[model samples]
Target: MAKYHRIIMNGESYYREYRYGSDSYGEMLSEEELVHMLLEEVVDEEIEISEREIESALRRIPDREDRYLLQNYIRCLERVGRE
Candidate 1:
């Protein structure tokens, strides 16, 4: 038998238990939190885009603020499985 627990941090729920003898698991998150985490961790340059591509794209986007705003939107779309 096993027991599991959960906790919320920064407005997101996280599991506090682990299951042995398996290689699968799942969790849940609010849209806001999911977007934040995915932007911060899940989707980094190493995940898909190469450094050269990122550099090229960065050069094409002139405004720093606009670039950042677009990046945030991209993260949101990715988290929602649209990208």
Candidate 2:
């Protein structure tokens, strides 16, 4: 069975999901510790693409208007970070 545990630390409330058998031997973690553990689970990879392949893909964009629109959208995002 699964259980929901609510922890209040430094006036902030945080919830953790605990699976009985799986987490039985584990100690509860503080909010920052839990965040760090979650981040450590992410895998980062690097991919390489050829210049010819990049040009070919860009060529498939159909029209200059669409390309310009995409460029404008990218510029707007650079000016303002995602909310």
Q: Each model's TM-score, in the order given? A: 0.30, 0.43
Model 1 RMSD, rounded to 1 decimal = 12.0
Which pairs clash in the backbone of model 2? none
What is the TM-score of candidate 1?
0.30
lDDT of 1 by residue, 1-83 (tens): 33234567877666533366564444654556555765776455654657588657867998999888878886786799853
- For 40-68, candidate 2 gives per-residue lDDT tens digits of 66647657857587557666898989877
Error of 2 at 75 (Å): 3.2
lDDT: worst 10-residue window of model 2: 21-30
- When summed lDDT is taken over every stretch of 10 residues in candidate 1, the lowest stretch is 16-25
Best by TM-score: 2
Report how far off residue 24 is in candidate 1 (Å): 46
Judged by lDDT, which candidate is best?
A: 2
Candidate 2, residue 39: the lDDT equals 64
Taking the candidates one at a time, how many backbone clashes does each contain? 0, 0
